[model samples]
Target: MRPKQVFVANHTSMIDFIILEQMTAFAAIMQKHPGWVGLLQTTILESLGCIWFNRTEVKDRVDASRKFREHAHGDDNNPLLIFSEGTCVNNEYIVMFKKSAFEIDVSVCPVAIKYNKIFVDAFWNSRKQSFTMHLLQLMTSWAVVCDVWYLEPQTIKPDETSIEFAERLMISHRAGLKMVPWDGYLKHSRATIL
Candidate 1:
């Protein structure tokens, strides 16, 4: 397939992807797979040489957007990983996806997360936690759900918004696992969710 960004922007749940990251790392030991892991093509990741979107200057965001718009259909091997959640949720229920699905024309893989345990928040050593630190929290936290399920690669019509596509996926994934909805899950550090 061509190189394009997949956006997963669900309601702001917190560290949801953190668990998925760890799951993928472990699943790597399973069997044959396709391509590298997927994530939201955030500008922050782009700045660090991540295949996702880059955070350029204000003027540059537009430029980058245009660049992808132009060559998205032609590039390959460097496609973006989208969160699709758009915001964040506690794995209980997801709100809706943004407009990512309609932005590009390509196949999309939806991964839904279910944590058996969820922590509220935690104390951190640093004043402001780094993105990496947050990820580590989810990895080490027992409150996280160890189970995971990946749905088949489905087609997102050009007319569909990211929300319409993501909701359908989120519903399917949770149903597969029979995971009950969770609530009151905010954010935390090593001491919190862990």
Candidate 2:
């Protein structure tokens, strides 16, 4: 386990966080949703080293970042895992990463995950379907197959800002996944939260 290392990845589904946790034994930063989804996930994931946060709220993001620093820089052994996209995409296109993950001054490890939807569509669309329905669909499938790769650790350059560093790592992760080069432009800005 590399101390002071932030694991960054593209968000594909709700299962993405659990999968990363199982693979790397690292804690994750989860966005707090409303309704049953939030309650259920909080109950299940909070014990698993997840830091529940509201992505749109500035105070929540700030508090979450502080908690991250405490856990990551303190004696706690689990490294910080951030799904920087702040939302799940189909994995074909990479989205702009949230800067909160980049705010930390540490080595960032980029992880790329690709899923084979032949057996089942693993992409969870919370806006369209409920969590239980998604889980039922997954259960009916033969299996979920994904390719997870860990790229080399990237350190912040002496002269580079966190925004630039995050953009660099985002490019690296997109390349690692063999995705069409995305310039890392976010459709929406969370400047208020930043």
In TM-score terms, which candidate is top? 2
Error of 1 at 86 (Å): 3.1
Worst lDDT 10-window in candidate 1: 25-34
Tens-digit lDDT string for candidate 2 (1-194)? 57788888887777877677677567787777788878767787666677877756999978988888777675565777887777777756666677766777677898887777789878876568988999999888889987777888998888987778877875435544434334333333334654
In candidate 2, list every pair of residues with a backbone clash: none
Question: Please, what is the TM-score per model?
Answer: 0.49, 0.81
lDDT of 1 by residue, 83-145 (tens): 443334444455444454545666666655544544624223234685467668856776644
Superposed on all Cα atoms, the candidates' RMSDs to the truth, in angstroms, are 10.2, 4.9
List the global CA lDDT of all models. Answer: 0.43, 0.74
- Cα distance off (Å), candidate 2, residue 94: 0.8
**Clashes in predicted model 2:** 0
